[model samples]
Target: MKRWLPLSIIAATLAVAGCSKAPNGDTNTSTSSQVAKTTANEAYLALADDYFNHDLALNPISATYVGINDYNDQFGDQLTDKWLKQRHQLNKGFLAKAKKIDRSQLSQQLQLSYDMFVYNRNLDLVEETFPARMIPFNQFYSPLFSMAQLGSGGSFQPFETVEDYQNWLARLEGFISFLNRAEDRMREGIRSKVVLPRTLVERMIPQINAQLVQDPTESLFYAPIGQLPESFSDADKQRLTDAYQSFISEKLTPALLDLSVFLKDEYLPASRGSDGMWGLPNGKLWYQYLANRNTTTEMDVDDIHELGLSEVARILAEMDQVRQTVGFKGDMAAFFDYLSSDPQFFFDTPQQLIDGYMGLKDDINQVLPDYFDVMPKADYEVRAVEAFREKSAAGASYQSPAVDGSRPGIFYINTYNLRAQPKWGMTTLSLHEAAPGHHFQISIKQELTDIPQFQKFGGYTAFEEGWALYAEYLGVEMGLFEDPYQYFGKLSDEMLRAMRLVVDTGLHAKGWTREQAIQYMMDNSAMAETDITAEVERYMAIPGQALSYKVGQLKILELRAKAEQALGDKFDIKEFHSQVLLTGSLPMAVLEDKINYWIASKS
Candidate 1:
């Protein structure tokens, strides 16, 4: 999975509370004539810069992640009405201005940029229509989980300096307010019948309880103090340590306990019994919007549900070929069971699991030259998922590198259950989550020059996840999946995505229970029951996100095939990839336009 900074971060806070400078306006041009004479490129680029800087101010956490330290000390309250109103107005105002820009006067590249900017702003505006704020967080997308990670000293939150440590203490104050407001929102959700499913709430209680420690040092929030810089004098270190310990015990612990107790005693009981979004108010329409938003297309739930079924069948047939090649006896189900049960496929230790993925970096990097010309300058490392949230997290996920290159991209492999981390799945998992996949695509986007910061950082889930899935398939052409088991692993990983298409829509639109979704995955693929359950619950938590993988992968595959046939001997595989990647993550329709234009110019 490619981890996305939640869009909710941008939808919060007071008006520009940070160290960001105002946009350098055209101070010399005092008249309307000068403004009117501004070129489309100049106007559009200015708007892009305005949007990026303004967004960074509101979304301080995201600012840190993107390598901007100006807002590191701030945490805007996302759950408040004031924040929601500002976020809506921000998108609305930008969309209006973006629409007025004359596309005809812009160069080809700016035209693409203009279209993407409008699409994103329009989508952001549409997202505000749904009452998502009423149901603030879940086990998978909780801010609490995110904050804990930031506090752990391993994530984007820097602990290298005294200012950095002080920044966190200030951020912690805002986090307490966020938790209080989240409780208020959940209470509102209960009244509105927009609460999370009971299972999701049940999972969340434990995660929240994990934070309610008797000793402040035992808390994840205390991690930064342990790694305080050696340069600090003993007196300064003591002061900082005392400050952190007090914050964790007096403020953070009580806030966590309140939320945890509320969930177990009040909220969990009120959570809905049904599994899908169909149970929420205006849920059908809301899910339809998400499907369209996540996939960056007009695909409705029915279109996606049917597409998933067809893809699942097609991939199963391919899996059968691998089953036969491996000389596995009996039916496909038997083969799935064999693969799931076999002890040889399991990793012995968590370090070995991390090492397995780490080991693939060299061979995978060696093959990159043949298929891709544009590669990320920033390197990546594989690490085990943190103990707090790994049980509920995806099998693996990729975090993009910091833009300043201070931090490398992280490929987090979940080793909570050894059985879930099968040896055969390592190659395909690595290909999808790390190299030539998210790490390559996202880093290259961030590194691109002459583009707006929004273009570098903001991306369509369909395009990003789709490209990663496509990269997994590219492993075959790169000769990385030559082993029959590894090939099965490829198919198995693909099957998980294919099933997600069916399951995400099924759970959200088609009234499927959680159990039904889990059973469907187990029937189709050799994934462990535990893994399948985690995936199914994940779909329930965030409807329509899972659909991005297949929807995006298929679109890219279609465009590639079209180019291959159109150019014939002229088609360069490397160039096809470069064209797709160099432009950053685009809407699928825009991507089609781009590829079609490339083919036309070549012809």
Candidate 2:
């Protein structure tokens, strides 16, 4: 759910030196070395701008959703083979263009830019073999659900102008084509034995069903019409209303029904019963590639699994201390059962679930400065996840602030199941999702002016997500997890992340069955049955992504420990944090190199 507008803003204004000839034909000569440096810098900057602008134009809806309102309502022909070819060619052209520039002539920021361009180009080399577009929709992330967000009146689609309303109508037409293409690709997947799990298909049924309401008034997609601009005359309104009805009845509804039937009747039956990617051709190699891309490391599955096991064992021992402090007359397993089944910790109502998180904002704000410095100037808010996508979305997720400062960073707490939002988990969740976690990391990164646009706005999952997971540990230092049960919640959360390293590799690399992975989680953590099922399914949908959190957290912690030891008395937590944040998110190896430079400089 990382938005692109902030990155666009950063990249948009990055000025590079290039001089055009005067209309008067006055040629002011400069030193050859100076001219060469300027040309090189300008060439690099132009390439960066080209990449950014091309990306923004191609994914205009993404641009709009991320608060880049210039291209307010648009979506590309994401389904066409020609579009894919163009996208690949675009990347290829940029890569070739970037390589011709001299890196040594540019500033440090530009050097990072050159390196990232090359790294991404290398990543593109592996993309063709993966066939990611083949298996697009799952229970977790899907373009269908994303379209609903934009079409829904409360989100990015501007309703104040008649043109805006018409813009969406055009966008929906484009989306219909994309969805059809998606279905075609998925059919290919069916033949290839690369389909999603049956469980995921079943989950998607409800999402499609929600769009099938016979009454246009009650449909979620009707919101735009309901809240259409007041500037529209009655004639215009009536015309729009008629057009929308026909579009829905004739186009949208049919598409939804077709997709739903396809999922239930065609795709589900062919889906591999097993959860792991290991069942596919070269699955182990595929997973290794994903791990490298996700964590930016060469650590193999066995290494990650072993690391997870060690971390899980260490966290469980800490949880045992919490049980002892509570004076519970039970074994660790029994205590875990007690925690899971107890209604005392559960919220009875959805508002209470939301209020519980809302309350934490004030409580944590008072203690935020205690841990480190560099807070985001943009305000933050908490809201429940929208009902349509909440069922499949992560328990809690963060959305960054708008680049123009019009929208605040949003911490969306899922209230789909009240039982899932336990009171004890709120503190750690808030810290991770709001303060010092995603909001702190992302917003501050966006605010940085010293770095290149790509570095400032770009992200590595391991660095960004790892830092968020690491933020949970910082709760202990902030004096937020003072209560033993709350402290145990932190350990339980850590254990879940550790479990991901094991289960993600288990599913993709080790050929572990879905049931087997779920059982492993049940045996290891205090997670509820509902939570465990959701987590496993998420890993199945997006392999190796979950691994980044734990891998990144450990790296950050290692570097922090190294900094504190190396600098000794001169070690400043604020300065250390500032250094980490100043670079935005980088690959772990790159992050290590950057931090090492900081450490050496202090000496």
Candidate 3:
């Protein structure tokens, strides 16, 4: 899983200062036409820049993640009515201006930007109609979790200078404001009946309690103080340390405790008993909107449900083939049990797990060039997921490098439960979260000079996740999954995605309970009970997101198959990959159009 910030504007403004006027005060046809296109493109680019820059101001934490530090000390008040109105007006105004730009007169690239800008702004406008702001924070996606990661000092929040330290202190104050607002919003959710499941709210209690420490130095927020630069004067260091300790104990800790108490004493009792999105007001339409938004397609709920069922059946057969090859004599259920319990398949320690993923880096890097012509300049490294959030974190996930290359992409392997991180799953997991998967796709996009900041930094769930899932399948063709057990890992991971399609739709659309979704997963794959529960709750917390992996992978595969069949011997794997990646992330429809154009030109 790649950490995706919620803002979805992917546009760039190319400021072509001016178009040259015709000589002798007379217009030349070709020159005039060129000038018109340039003027139109620049005009649209300026509009895009306006939208992009304002969005960053509204999401300062996300701005920090993308390597922009202009608002590092601020956190936007996103759930307030004033904030919502400002956001709506921002989109509405930019969208109207964007539409006024004659897309036909812009160059092809700017036209793509124009279409995406309009689509995203329109989607934002539609999304605001739902009561999402009322239910702002959940166990899974929240500003709270982002702050925890940043405060740890190991993440993106810069602590390089005295100003950096002060920025974080100021940012902490803003974060506390967010917590207060979140409590207000969650209360609103309770009143409107747009609340989270009881199960998810239960998870939040422990998460919040973990932050309430009596000793400020023992807090995760105290990490930056310990890492103060050697260049700092003795007085400055002591002053900053005293300030941080006081802030943590006096301000931040109390805020966390208040939020935690609010959850236990009030919010939990009010949380919904029903697990799926259908339990909320107008939830059915909301889930459908999310389904379309996340997958970037107009796929109906029942169609997605059926597609999941079909994919599940198809992947199950492949798993059986792997089972037979491994000489397992028992039935699939027994095979799942044996695979789940076997000690040989599990990593002995967390360090070993980290080493196992790191070990694959060299082998994967060697084969990558055979399949991809373009590669990221910023490399990646494997690390254990921080203990604070590891319990709720995915089994493995990727964080893209900082835009300035100050940080390498991080492939976080959760070592909380070793059974969930099996030995056989290493290859497929590495391929998905690390090299030639997220790291490749995302880093390449950030490095792209031609696209706008939004396209470079923001992405659709389907396109980004879909590409990673497709990368896993690509590993098999690359001969990385040669061992039967490793091949089983591939099938296992694929089954997890295939099951997401069935389970996400089942939970949200069909009103499956949390237990039922867990059982569905347990019956289908050899995943640990811990992993199954976490994943199901993840879906409950953020409906329609789990559906992206398979929905996206299938589309990419379908496109590749079309390309392979059309071009035959003329097809080049490297070129096809470049075509998919070099444009940065795009909508499914736009991606297909681009591919079709490429195929036609090749033909």
lDDT of 1: 0.88
Compared with the true structure, what per-residue lDDT tens digits does model 3 show for residues 1-603? 122211222221122222334556444654566667766866876777777888988888888888888888998788888989999999898889987898898766667767888999999999999999877878888676788789777788898899999999999998899889989998988898989999998999999898889899999888898899999999999999999999999999999999999999999999999999999999999999999999999999899999989988998999899889989999999999989999998978899888878789998998998999999999998988888888898898899998898889999999999988889899999999988999999999999876667888889999999999999999989999999899999989988998998999999989899999999999999999999999999999989988888989999999999999999999999999999999788888888888898899999
Q: How high is the lDDT of residue 68 in model 3?
A: 81
TM-score for each prediction? Answer: 0.93, 0.92, 0.95
Model 3, CA-based lDDT: 0.88
TM-score of 1: 0.93
Lowest summed-lDDT stretch of 10 residues in model 2?
9-18
Give the per-residue Cα lDDT of candidate 3 at 594: 82
Which number leads on TM-score? 3
Per-residue lDDT for 1-603 in model 1, tens only?
A: 122322322221111222223245533333332233234656787888888888887789988888888888888878788888889889999989988988875556768888999988888988988989988889889898889888888788988899999999999999999889989998998898999999999999888888889999998889998898899989989999999999999999998998999999999899998899999989999999999999999987898999999989999999999999989888999998888888899988999888778889988998899887889999999989999888789889998887889889999999999988888898899998899999999999999875677889899999999999999999999999889999999999999999999999999999999999999998899998999998999899988899999999999999999999999999999999999999799999999999999999999
Q: How far is 171's C-alpha from truth in model 2 (Å)?
A: 0.9
What residue pairs are clashing in model 2? Answer: none
